[model samples]
Target chain A: MIGRDEVLHVARLARLALAEEEIEPMARELSAVLEHVERIGELDLDGVQPTSHVVASSSKVDVTRALRPDEPRPCLPREVALAQAPAVSDGGFLVPSPQA
Target chain B: MSAEVLALSAAQASAAIGAGELDAGELFSFYRERAEADREAGQEGLNCFTWVAREAPGKAGTRVRETVPHWPDTVRMHESAGSSLAGVPLAVKDLFCTEDAPSQSGSRMLEGYTPPYTASAVARLREAGAPLLAKTNQDEFAMGSSTENSAFGPTLNPWDRTRVPGGSSGGSAAAVAAGLAPWALGTDTGGSIRQPASLCGVVGLKPTYGSVSRYGMIAFASSLDQAGPLTRDVTDAALMLAHMIGRDACDATSLAHPQQIALPSAERLDGVRIGVPAELEPEGSSIEDGVRRCFHRALALAEELGAQVNTDISLPHAPYGLSAYYILAPAEASSNLARFDGVRYGLRAASSSKVEGATDLLDMYTRTRHDGFGREVKRRIMLGTYALSSGYYEAYYGRAQKVRTKIAEDFATAFASVDLIATPTSPGVAFALGEKTADPWSMYLSDYFTVPMSLAGIPAISIPCGLSDEHARAGANGAEANGSGLPVGLQLAGPAFSENKLLDAAHALERAIAFDSTAAHV
Candidate 1:
């Protein structure tokens, strides 16, 4: 079960600000989701290795694809890369200062 | 007039264009008119597209020629190669980035943000000469099942305007259904494409995971996401899948080897063994009477056509798919969505006027995401952050992964005895517009039947089997009570790389049922 405090904590972790009225409702919704998902814990998965990716690899060695060769390739031009930036400054993306 | 060509399956349209029976220009006009009509029709118009291209390719000064510089090499390769998908117009779900059109992913956060490239799947479609006609709407970041989570507003069901078309690929499904375009691209992460395609009475194929490259397609759940086609029938889906699938270095998770799927040569499923999971029966789960009736009738039809239908198969862990999907998808979503910080692409909350309200940089990040994301998006993000948070990881995400493994093993075990599995794509027909919006759990449960295949990373197809009248009468509200003649989808799933086999079974079922998919109004 989740509460308003947990909701706020999670929001902080996700870097999402919640309005005052949204906190309780968000908590309620999250609690419902948790309750629904909690059913997974009832079944014992003693030796099951979790599947991170569903790549169709029949053998352990073939599961992971070889990484692409590290030859340097052409990257997106600066103007194109910055096209969608909300704030740009001196050909670089701008954000609020890291230091508070 | 446009209805004739619009009604043609993508394969038919392509062949017509290839044979010179249908000119690309006229086909484009038909699709353009239909797109404009749908856009103008407002609420009843299906409202399927987020952005409709003004002119089709081959026209002087068209968007394709104007935007070729931003397109990847594959798309540019076909620009000089003349018409190839033989000029069949393609509508794309907004989740796939098209350099010419704004790829908003049905969220206000990325409004008007045009990516510098096109999705690899879409590039292949272009390479095959499928003209881009429009960009369809979807759930915000492919989150909701009803498409109601769209900031642009929900797409009305073409079948019955009052009912939903299903989501987050609702627009793509509805567009194809209403004859706006011959076929469209849709991504499935926990049944986005299949469920909506089922509800809208079209053929939707969710290819085995990693079969199609996801490059330039906005990420929702990294591991679960796979792009496929929403078409009028099985053959068209096969054609689109054949063109769209290939290995791409841009997406590391893309398949190492290209998959080649072609139209099935056999007309009947003589030796196919179709497994009907016992847990999915109406007596056990919440499947509606109407859907159950249609499913049984389709199974009977399949049996008559030489396929063996086995109803005793038990997938004990299949029912846990929804829970596991919710946990795993959100955990990945929380991680995938972290790139949307205010500094880079997408909307930012920080502004000169809002500076007074924010305390610092942290405040900006918080406010930006909070203000940008919709209610459902925030809810999932919060849930995912909680699950992946330190100390809670093993309890939620880790356990969900194990359940995913169990579900995959269940399918593997079942497939050893049977060639394919059968179920109703959704439990019921589409509900009215606002019916289940308040209850996210109810909406999530709509995908219960289709989520298991997604977890198992298998191929599945949803095809129109029959019409259901139950939701029209004694269902939720009178809005759906008029026997809206809603279409019911029969889902057929197979093991990984079994697209040809799955499509063969689906084509057999399709020919047997002979369900008319034409919307009354369209």
Candidate 2:
């Protein structure tokens, strides 16, 4: 069973704030999901390499490098890119100051 | 005649408009009226649309042309002026970025956020002259099987108002099923498209991974995510896909297809060997009796249609697909979603007085995400973070990826002897609203059959095979039941870049089944 400390650690890593009362339930749910997926750990995958993507090119070919030439091109205008920002100042995104 | 116009398939609507039999504006108005009527008349509410474009769509310089310079020159047209899908009114799932409409991705985090640019698929569709109808609802960040995870509200199934329209593309499927629009676009990350299409009785296709560009679609699980068409039938799906595919410099992952894909024109599936995995034999507790009956019925129809059905196939590692997907998808999600901190865009939580000194950036980040994201989103984020964390990475994410390799190898071997593989799109018909919400594991299991295809990065389609009569009998009436009955979907999947073949087989089976359902006016 996953403990409250574990759940809180996960929430912290995920940058989500959990209320004190929500911790027990989150732990229970996460534990259940982990238990369900635990079957993968039991399989014998000796010498098998992990697949990052189904489309990732094989060893003989580096197909990803063949994408369009890396010349400088027109991109999203600064104003348009920043149009959705919740807070912006001096032609840039604004955020709270980092604490000491 | 207006109702007839609204019910026209994407192909029929475009052809009619092009042939001068139907006016584009008139056809758009008919669909808009039906959609508005459906929204207003429902007491429980269909809740299909997040935002409906008030102005009619046409050939125009709508917004960007007025402000941006050199806009027309940068835009590329892959198809000629006379594309088949010209002037078809279509709905887009909120996940895709549309320049004219808000793309909230069914989350409060981006409640009113309109993207600066349209998604590549949306741009291609627009260039082909398909009008934007409305932005449809979905599970917040495409996290849930049912659209119950939508920040606004759940989109009820058109087949039965009391049940769910399977999601995170539920709104798209429900919109098409209810005749609000001829078709809609949906993104699938672990069965978001096919499962909902199965439940709603609409035809949906998830093209091969990287076949369609993911440039402006919101990220869920980066490697596993894909966008596809959810239409009334296979032909419409084929037409929509024709315009929506091609390589884009904006998205490096897009498949290289300088030339347009030519769909197979064969009417018969002669000599086509369809592998039926023994593990998914529709027996035991997980498979519903009605679902099993409909699956076998579909296969039998295929046999009669000249396709050689091979039921002796075994995918030993396929049954473990869902387990691996649950690990890999959430891990990627946790990493992809890290950008939503209360910094660049989206909602920022107002600091509360309860924690007097919690006015720092850390507080803002945590509080914003805590309040903005829905419950299911949070659960997945937590699950993902836990799996990817240092101590548990090898036991969980590492093992999951290894298993994914085994699953992919198994599919490669199966395809060596078989032309395609078949399965029931979902375990059963659409369940009652809120039935599986309480149990997260059960909800995850809903994508059991569909995830294996996503894992293998193959093309798959879900076509309406039949209806669950038992579910129909339990309903109050045919109209209140939404249409004929709850829909059952048959999934046809093929190896990479096999979309044309997959669509051909699905088209043949669709003709043989001839399943029909239409939602009644409330």
Candidate 3:
């Protein structure tokens, strides 16, 4: 079952801005979710390998090989790049502050 | 329009377009206008989209069809996946990056961010002549069962204003259900597409992993996410899926499997075998009464059409599916979501505004992430991070992986007995808005049936079986798709890479229910 503190903590982490009225209802609902998920505890998985994906027939890509080749790609002009910027000063794009 | 034309499956649409009665341009506009109207009606509630594609100047969503990639081996796809449907009006879940549109993934952090290149799936869809009409809404990073977790407001169910559209693909399903788009694209990781489909009363398919490219789909659980279509019917879904499928060099995990479905052939279910689980699916445990009623009716209908149905079968470790899914999905999500640190790609809060022009990198990262992600997403990332942490890794993530192995074994055994295991897509139909929003556990439980398939990476589709009484009240918001009679969706699953039989069985049963039951909503 979901604990109230856990729910509140999760909400705080998620930045949900949930009101006081929502906590208890959420706790109750979350408890149901945990209970349902706990149903998995009923199975005997002593030797079972945990399967994360359905199809398991492929090799992982080499991270080093993923880098784009040195083929010279076209670059947009500096002014063209800054054209869509909402605000620009000096050689940089400026953004508005969220706190204000 | 002839009933045949209106009734045209995706395969049929392409064939008809190829044979030349309907103009490809006209077909795209017909659906686009419908989508435009759905958007207009649903603007305040569904939150179905963040951005609609600007009107394509030359094509009107059709000009690029002549450039569609040739697919000779799959004629049905070439017919449907390649033509008007390719250029058709449809929405993509905003989780995917598009060159021309913003991909918020339901977060404020990435608000207004448009990538330089489109996702691979989007590129393939475009190459096949389908244009991106709109960016459908989704849960943040595809993390939650409901779109309620979106940093953007929740996407309401199209069928009932007061209810939720199931998520993280809720917006896509609701858009198609509300007739906002001819079809829309969505990702399914633990029932993301299918659950919402059941709620909205439309067709939602989660193709087997590797069946479709995940290269462009924004990763939630990298191993589990499979992009599929929310079409009005199974055949259309198959056709569109065909065009978007094939081995992509970009996706290392993609399957080079060759399993092409024959649309309209779903009408033959005689030899089709279905497995009913004994343990994982207890009445009142994971299923509700109405879903069961419709499931029984569907099974009976399939039996009437000569299919074999097995009961009391043991999917022995299947019960552990949910536990395994939670551990694995979050572990993957934690890893996938880490890329959003405030350096690039999305919105950034003021580095200059903090404490009188104090400049530091740490504050920027913390403030951006803290403000950008929503509650469910943040909770999941933390949970995933905890699961994957050094001390907890073996106890949680490792242990969960072992459980996943067992779940897969049980599924393999069950499939050996029969081709598919059938169950209600969602426990109950769409619940009222905010009913389960506060409770993350309940919201997670809503994905019970769907999560297992994602865990096993199997293909499953939710086809409307019947509707509820609430469907009658759906007319208030111009819910044209809410049939006067309630709609129920019958799910069909097949062995990995065996979408042919799955679609075939579903199509056959769809027709047997009535040579007359062939119908489409918005």
Candidate 4:
């Protein structure tokens, strides 16, 4: 069972607000998810080094390469690239408002 | 062939088309007819799809112009397409963006939201010769074990109407198993692809992270997710893999090393050594007797094929694999899924419903994510946020990462001696729909044999081992083991970028077992 303060804390951590009506239901769901997480906590991992990269880091393969000198390359024409744009002004494609 | 051409595996279709036995157009129409027929049969009951595309395969501009449905339709028309892969019909997991169809990703939140660009994996397939069929259903945000978590309703397993097709790649598995398409693309994070494939008794490969490009895959658990091929046979799977891999500028984790992978042509069990983890096969774990017998039979077949099989290998840290995976998967998922904050991409709750201009962008994010994502996805977000939050971070998320490291190390220590790890892909055959829903423990346990590989970021595939005698004895309704009555799977797994070898060994078993005709759907 989760405490009232614990429920509120989970909601805040998850960046959600719960109504009084939703609190009990939300608390049950939250408790179930946390219980599983708690089950994950039973493991003992003393002196084990953490692995961030799934692929083994290699000095040869993973070395940061020097920036290549600019070479002439094929490029898509601006007009063709901009053909699908909804709006354009002053040689620039004008996109719609993300807020809208 | 009447409708048999469309149902043929990638290898079969390509071979026949190249041999002048079958035509690409015939293969296209067979699936076009079947997809239409099955949609009619399944749309009401299975809920296995979000949207069906209006266009048929073999059209121009489908690779880049259409949604990133894997293996573009246009390339199949190329005469050179008959080289490696001539024609294989494929279904896309709805999570990937497809231009012609809506990329809903199984959420009411993104209903009818078409992406502006096609994903790179889909582009690669189009460049190869495979035809893009349709988009299959998935869990909202690819979260649930059963595809029941989809906003559109659950995807029922093809074999039994009541049981689930394991998800979030449920529809992809179902489409392949029920012969809607020869193959499909599925994203696996913590056994999304493997579990569904095991339940469906089809071959699903969760390629090593970074082996395949995620340039167009919708993010669920960033650290864990990898796009892979799911097909009726390992040969078809290998051909599909050869088509959709290599480095991509759009994805940083994309493999710098892209080596040509040969499929069943390269399958060699001779001189191969296998490791069987003792923990997975331990008695009384809900793994049915049929699965165990089949696993043993597969092992014996491998041994008979001149492979050395080792049993009783103890990777003790593997015992904690599920624990580590749950923690890291949810932790990564929480952070990655925060992008759907109703600000940039997807739906936002209406301002009129808000408290008279009091709510802002943050309020909109909290409301949309809280309401939009399914219960499992939401539950994970909350649990992960709490784990990543201050005061609890060191105790939960931090320690889980440590356990994850230990699990990887344990596998490395074992793999030093053995070439690959083998287990029963699932503990048992598919279960009833509501059977495990009441208890998440059972649901998590469903992937017990498979999760360790996902946590280690290795490749794993499930090939049908044998059939369930129990289901056969009771006739039609006894158990929903699999549509083909196969209850067994030889869960083959290998370390990162070891797909070529894994596919080779899986092909060896596929031939040795000789269940291809009996096991394949339609």
Clashes found in each candidate (C-alpha, N, C closer than 3 A): 3, 0, 33, 6
**Model 2: what TM-score?**
0.94
Model 1: native contacts recovered, as a fraction: 0.73
- Relative to the true structure, candidate 1 reaches a TM of 0.94
List the candidates' TM-scores in order: 0.94, 0.94, 0.82, 0.87
Tell me the tens digit of each residue's lDDT in model 4 across B1-522. Answer: 564664466787888888989877777667766666666666454555666544556542234453222232222322222255565556889988665567888887677677766667776676676666778889888887778778877787766655678988999888787777778898998888888887777888888777677876888877778888888889888778877766665566666544566666644588898999877742226678888788889999999888999985767867667766777787888888777755444566554134335655556656777667766677677767777887887787778777777777778878888998899888767777788776666677777787777777778888888765544322223553444454466789887778888998998888888765324343
Model 2 lDDT at residue B404: 83
Chain A TM-score of prediction number 4: 0.47
Tens digits of lDDT, candidate 1, B284-365:
3488888889999999999888999998888899888999999999989999988876777888874521333435678778
Task: Please give the range of 10 consecutive residues that has the lowest summed lDDT in model 4 chain A.
Answer: A58-67
i-RMSD of model 1 (Å, 1 decimal): 2.9
> Could you give the candidate ranking by DockQ, starting with the highest?
1, 2, 4, 3
Q: Model 3 misses residue B53 by how many Å?
A: 2.6
Q: What residue runs in model 3 are displaced by over 4 Å at the alpha carbon?
A: A1-47, A50-53, A57-100, B1-13, B40-46, B60-86, B280-286, B351-356, B469-474, B477-486, B514-522
Which is the winner by TM-score between candidate 3 and candidate 4?
4
Residue B41, candidate 3: C-alpha displacement in angstroms: 4.8
Off by over 4 Å in 1: A57-63, B59-83, B256-259, B281-285, B350-359, B473-484
Q: After superposition, how far is residue B191 of candidate 4 from its true place, in Å?
A: 0.8
Model 3 chain B lowest lDDT segment of ten: B66-75
Local distance difference test, each candidate: 0.82, 0.82, 0.67, 0.71
